[model samples]
Target: MKSSGKRGTRSFGAVELLPTWHWSQFTFFTMVDHNGNESSAPYFILIGLPGLERAQFWLAFPLCSLYLIAVLGNLTIIYIVRTEHSLHEPMYIFLCMLSGLDVLISTSSMPKMMAIFWFNSTTIQFDACLLQMFAIHSLSGMESTVLLAMAFDRYVAICHPLRHATVLTLPRVAKIGMAAVVRGAALMAPLPVFIKRLPFCGSNILSHSYCLHQDVMKLACADIHVNIIYGLIVIVSAIGLDSLLISLSYLLILKTVLGLTREAQTKAFGTCVSHVCAVFIFYVPFIGLSMVHRFGTQHDSLLPVIMANIYLLVPPVLNPIVYGVKTKEIRQRILRLFHVTTQTSDP
Candidate 1:
């Protein structure tokens, strides 16, 4: 009988030949299979600027504390203005709106950022990330618009004192506040929609502790040329245009005030100084951040942190302080409500 085991044959005969395989080809196939397996698994790596642990800790702790103070301070202002009948005017109404915006603004990013630092947790859900981005930018945009409106209100009140009551009536102030909200929402809503639609197939790690527009956009896989162009247009129109208008309004106010008597001008300037300071503290860093993010180098991570603190946290903390110290009536009212004695008696 023929051999019961398999055998290799060189010529055709009654026996079958076994298939032959080259060892080199088998090794090459194995190597390719191993590489394909390695490539198929996704890798997770922490990617962002380092050396910020100490700075982040210091910054985040104080910022979180200040955020609490900001919320309480602004809320107190809103309550005082709303409840006190004597404070019912266009200026105070605008102040109340500003205080409300401050609360929203601080609450938007500071708390989450603090948690990230304290917990060493940097991962954020895609939707939550987008929401945070929208909230912060939207509130910021609203704040700028509101500042412009407030400047106009002051302009009308001081320059056109005769028509202040008619021009800045309750209905009119409400209408202006509504318009500011709508305008801000309209301007900022598009940013998130554009960002969300972009394909992010590569790195998911955000450079900053929070979800800023440019930071998130950097991770996009698809082309962002159009998005960048639209972003520039929006920033210029919304922030730049608003800043220019505010500056012009203040210039006119300054001209009008300068023409008044020394005492009158000082008093008028005092009335607006708080708002002006608040606006400056709020906008300078804001515009600076936009510029730096757009034009600055990738190594400039400190810019975002510093800018975030200045524009996001500082204004909210300082606004109440500025207005409280500048405005005597509100200060006294707050003292009276809190039962703090301001008067001294002599025997």
Candidate 2:
């Protein structure tokens, strides 16, 4: 096999293979040998940001601060929901579940990103990279399902007020949560496995500070049509379908609210404002990132990386704050919790 030695170009018998995409401009390839054996990197590098490489060290502080806030805020939500018997309703139950998923989603991607930015420890083992990818996408899907369940809870509370208790009993809510877990896990399980089977004979430096299935798949030298198709299927089945259902539920809710008295309408819509904010926070960045990855390759590469990181971090950091501020029960409980703590610690 002859070698061109430009961007690690190598001859695979009769075919001369150039690296894939513009990202190959950033790094060299270490591809398969003449025997078609896997010579891919056992570890991958996470370059934080493409255009702003010089500022990445300083960027770590804000990212780390956001991660800390996400963890603390979500934990407080969980603590309040668990301790306050009044919040044992289906709505708060789903909120608690969402908080848990938020924590998982941010934690899965942030620590490694912090390492890359703070210490430049960017090398991640192939297996560990795959694990992070699974955790992030799976938890994100589960969060979508949980949000859907919360929308349903709101629908029942506002539209079918008398039937709310009977319709969404604790057992049913628990079953819904379990289904979210199973569906998210089962659908995303093949993603990492598919990447594992593909021969990654190119630059293993990922586009973002994290390992996404889409980002990792692009590095593979083999035909990736299957990966692309399966990725779309997962998105459609999980986020896309869930989003449509949640929207439909809200439409029905709107109709119900329109028929109510003005005071009642205000009260009903107020209840959903936090959830609406949460939904937008999760989906906007997610869809933007997806579009940038699929369609905006010609645009600045930094757009996708920024959108991906926002998709991962924004919902977690903002959801808790939205709920704490918008939901009356949660806000009061948080205040009470602080009041008690302050009194207990007084000198």
Candidate 3:
């Protein structure tokens, strides 16, 4: 509902509401400066893929395909895991949560990205921008927590095979999932609020196709020491801690794997191949983006933008593919599902 009626400004109507709230729809306003000057209150011009404006249509095609494949593939994983009685295990359940997170996070950015590349529509309402930032960052933190939970599940399953069922029972896994969500939401709650409260008197042009915390933080006109410190603490306490614990859990898992017979070791370690790939896909780009943001400030702007996009888009696209092709159960179930559909449709 926050928008300016200036000549170049754009207003998104009811279609922009995340969940279609009537009261929050069809309203508009302009920003009032301290000296009684009025300007656009809640608008940002997203400079998507700078210097590549001519290739926007070409860029949209591949990105659109990635978005579709990510959604369909992850949804398929969820459906198979839920419907198949044989897959009602802790690992598949965690995978289902992972898929759901992928869909949620990607949805927050992909729509706006398509709008930018396809329609050349780059104006984003301020509130919607904050919402997108919240969803992307919180869901990213949730992904790390979910991965840590899965690491613990594997640690139990391999190291304490006898106690695996009792330790990671359905209720316990559910509790872990709830804890992950709560922890993420609690830690990331201040991110959007911090960015929102900051005065955006300067250029509101986002560096990428979608809203990201770092991208938005740099645009604030006010002193941002508090926001910077709190954001760092949230990242360290949540994602950093989860990454460290996940590493430790895998170390213990490796120790347990080493104690088994050679054949048993191969079989046991195969279970983690998919997870390791997914971890790398998610973390490598994230870590790279962080490093570049800190150390490569003098480098080309396109590099950071590319890294940030990869940090966001790669995991969702790769998680389902890795799980589907690497995990035997999912692959066989997908084949069987298609086979049944083919037979049913034969006339």
TM per candidate comes to 0.81, 0.90, 0.88
Off by over 4 Å in 2: 1-38, 298-300
As for TM-score, the candidate ahead, 1 or 2, is: 2
Top model by TM-score, which number? 2
31-127: candidate 2 lDDT, tens digit per residue: 5554556665667778788777679999899999999999999999999999999999999999999999999999898988988888878779899
User: TM-score of model 3 relative to the true fold?
Assistant: 0.88
Who is ahead in lDDT, 2 or 3? 2
Please give the range of 10 consecutive residues that has the lowest summed lDDT in model 2.
20-29
TM-score: model 1 vs. ground truth? 0.81
Question: CA lDDT of each candidate?
Answer: 0.74, 0.88, 0.82
- Find the candidate with the highest lDDT and give its number: 2
Give RMSD to native, each candidate.
Answer: 12.6, 4.4, 6.7
CA displacement after TM-score superposition, residue 109 of candidate 3 (Å): 0.5
How many clashes in each structure?
A: 0, 0, 1
Error of 2 at 244 (Å): 0.6
lDDT of 1 by residue, 1-347 (tens): 44435353222233222233322111111111212221110111121224666566665667778889999889889988998999999889999999999999888777667776676565566777888888888888888888988888888878899998988889989998998898888888888898867765444555566777777777676788877887788789888888899899889999999999999998999889988998898887887777777677764366665665677788889899888888887898888877643344322
Superposed Cα deviation of residue 162, candidate 2 (Å)? 0.9
Q: Give candidate 3 misplaced runs (Cα > 4 Å).
A: 1-41, 298-300
